[model samples]
Target: MSSIKVECVVKAHNEIGEGPVWEEKDATLLYVDIYGPSISRWNSLTKETERMSTETYVGCVVPRSSGGYVIGEGTRFAAVDWEKRSITTITHVDTEKSNTRFNDGKVDPAGRFFAGTMAVEVRPTELERKQGSLYALQPDHSVVKHLDQVDLSNGLDWSPDHHIFYYIDSLKYMVEAFDYDLQTGGISNRRMVYRLKEDEGIPDGMCIDAEGKLWVACYNGGRVICIDPQTGTRLQTVQLPVAKITSCCFGGKNYSDLYITSATKGMDEEALAKQPEAGSIFKVTGLGVKGIPSYSFSG
Candidate 1:
């Protein structure tokens, strides 16, 4: 095992901090507070954070090749004008239902945006299962439903070669791989790559490293685990300061540092007291690995 070092860079008490995209040119990290309904940019060097309310629970945010950002705003794919603090709805999806909302999303190597929905209401041990679906926003601003009957779409990433797509349906307790087509932005040949035991926690957001291993954040497990997708074996473990570690991505100038996000959602006073950094942003350094850059939406 390699020596891992962790630090708390920003004390953002977000309700449900989820999607994190690192912009190299600006030397900043952009992430969404799913329930804060906001998008935030944190400077890596200065540690300064700027947040803008999306007005609706934002599932994720990614830099748009056309400028600004493309956000999963509730049930819609919208364009976010950072400078104007304005949002323009590009299209609405899942218009037939209100029980689900957009959850996690990412851009493909071809510059297509993909996001999935999850049950809107959560009970102690149950949620409206299979009320969600996965969507793709093409470069032309058209919406397409690629997968349906999804319980909780969380993590989604592709292999370094862009041939295998990895995905997580939180309720399923496993990581799934699919044969991917870079040109068509399509996936098939679904298979399980990793499965977590009951005590290991739920898999949440994910990203790939240069070596093609998976760095997965465990929501209730409080750890970011590195897994060899080919063998379904655990290669490394990064224990965070708090449980409910929601998502993670690679950043830093060299793309070696790992930035993690957490959530305080559904935690009672007692639970909250046990982990005061429940909603803070964290960083892991000296992992001795580099990560691929986050793709931007072409449109």
Candidate 2:
């Protein structure tokens, strides 16, 4: 395996830049600033950026086959018009309970939106923490609770063959795998694929490369690791200067450039003083891996 080296590409100070997806058609990188309540697009070729704001916290954003984007925002799913800068709410989740909000999410191969919620308060009691649930938005705009009792639902991705699903609950510090029935949208046979020691930071957002390897952002660990899912073996580690690596995705024309997003949200003054590039976007060249294409909102 080759060594991973990250270099700063876009230095926009994002408060909580999370989910990142590459739009191949537009040759741009699309990501969300959760607390900023906005979705931003950056052109890899021109280095120009455009943003669309939302009324509530934006959790994730993905390209839609019919054009525009599907965005997960504070317990609701919406369609965003890039040209018009408009947002239309398609469905709402946990509307009555303001204490639970959307966290990390992604679109499945079938074009359905999959997003999860987290407790609003940082220190919720055991019961409140269990309120976080993973939701699936059907093509008809109907929603279903796929999984419950989740705490800090974060990383999500699918294997290259599309036969397995991987997810993470940050507090648990484990990356789990499920037998994914893609045609029917069923997940079974859950198993732990990766677990980090207490010294290593919790896993955050993740992506699967074409070789079926998982690349996970190690929050507070200041690194990204490539691991073999079946064997649970660490292939390589890419070090970063910042301690809070929020998420990463493969982009670039050839799908070889690895783009990473870090955060400065939870860092204290002392930590920020030491790592100034905490919230910057980084690009690592020569990754020698290709990522799966972003799923479009066929629904």
Candidate 3:
């Protein structure tokens, strides 16, 4: 197969575009504009875009089996009813810290919603530095803090076999793996899977293709790289016009099209001039890798 060629599929005027999830049922791409505090939907067939306003900065969004979406706002988890245009706060996270907010998150194969938190505004104390945590929310609305003491929790995914979980702390520029027990929600045997060199950009979001290869977004590298999870071998790289590529996922009817999200919030004038399409969504076809379908919240 040829190296993927990425092209802008949608030109979004978002200040920060982060999460991109493709809904197979509706043939639409759903993503959040974190700074915009809005959920945007794009119809791949009709090329129409729709926006829904929210009360907080939305970090990520996933489909719910019951006809709505489960989303992570700054420090809260909520369910949005698209039909009624209503939002119900299901759970509030990190309320005591005041400096932390929810970041990247995804659902496991067993239907549990997992999300991580990050410092919204840095403070000068140890408590403020250790405030971020990873949470697992059960269907009954109960939430559990599974892990803590993270700087910038982002980029979460699972291996195709459901036995390995991949996570990233962007500031550390490393991707870590944990042995995952699908039946018990137990994660152990944590170890570094891939550590980015100083020359490379920080690792942001990631996704696993059908073959179980990991596709990780390079925040300041202006590219997405495919890597062998077990061997840590770089397989391929798809260049983008923006330096802050945030996340990516395989979508489209066949799941062979790769969709990428980017950010423009931190760019200086010089960087912005070089990357005019900083916050736009790009698509790469002929990748030949399909991602696992996103699991919805069962409740």
Candidate 4:
């Protein structure tokens, strides 16, 4: 364990701040508050934050090559005009079920937008099982279902070589890897790459680094662990000020900074008072590592 400093860059105080993607073109960080039902952009240079309120839960937000942004919100994958704050739903799935919503996702190297869903109501031991699925919106704007019966489709990413797709279901308390087909946006040969102990908390959002290691945010564990996916070995541990750390991405110059997101959801007044920075956006430095830029949706 090496010494690293975690700074509270933004006192966001979101009920559930999740997705975080770096925008290199604008030098800003784009993230979503699932329960705040908002997408926000934090300018690293100016130390300012801009938020866009949405009508429903917004799971993830990413830059689009066509302009504006792409978000997996509610039950639809929509296109947003940030300047105008206009949202045009490109397509939707799982419409038959009203209790499921999109959770976490990212763009593949080939430009496909991938997202998954989970139940709307989740408690410690009470949950609606198998109500969600994973989906991909192709550059051509076509929808495809990759997996079903996903109770909690959370963090997802790919290997530096783009050959392996890593995913987390949260409830499984493990990370799964798949053989990725960039040309077709398909995944196969699923196998477990990493698993967490009961004390480690649920795995939430994740992103890969330049060295091909996986940085996984532990939702209830209060830390992020860097794992060598090849061997399921834990390499580094990043303790956070808040216990409900939701997601993270590497940003800043040379991609050396790890931008993390947390949530204030499910906490009582006593819990909130104990951890005032529960939902703040965090920046971690001195890890001596760098991450690759997030891919954008070409559609």
Per-residue lDDT over 156-237 for candidate 4, one digit per residue giving the tens place of the 0 to 100 score: 9999999999999988889999999998889999999999988779999999999999999999999999999998999989
Model 3 C-alpha lDDT per residue in residues 60-177, reported as the tens digit of each score? 8888888889999989999999888899999898878777877788888888888899887432112245668898877787887878988878899888899999998787788899
Show pairs that collide, candidate 2.
none
Ranking by TM-score: 4, 1, 3, 2
| All models, RMSD in angstroms | 1.2, 2.1, 2.4, 1.2
Every model's TM-score: 0.97, 0.95, 0.95, 0.98
lDDT of each: 0.91, 0.84, 0.84, 0.92
Which scores higher on lDDT, 1 or 4? Answer: 4
Of 1 and 2, which scores higher on TM-score?
Answer: 1
Model 3 global lDDT (CA atoms, 0 to 1): 0.84
TM-score between candidate 1 and the true structure: 0.97
Model 3 TM-score relative to the real fold: 0.95
Q: Model 2 — which ten-residue stretch has the worst lDDT?
A: 121-130
Candidate no. 2 TM-score: 0.95
Clashes of each: 0, 0, 0, 0
Model 2 residue 180 CA deviation in Å: 0.7
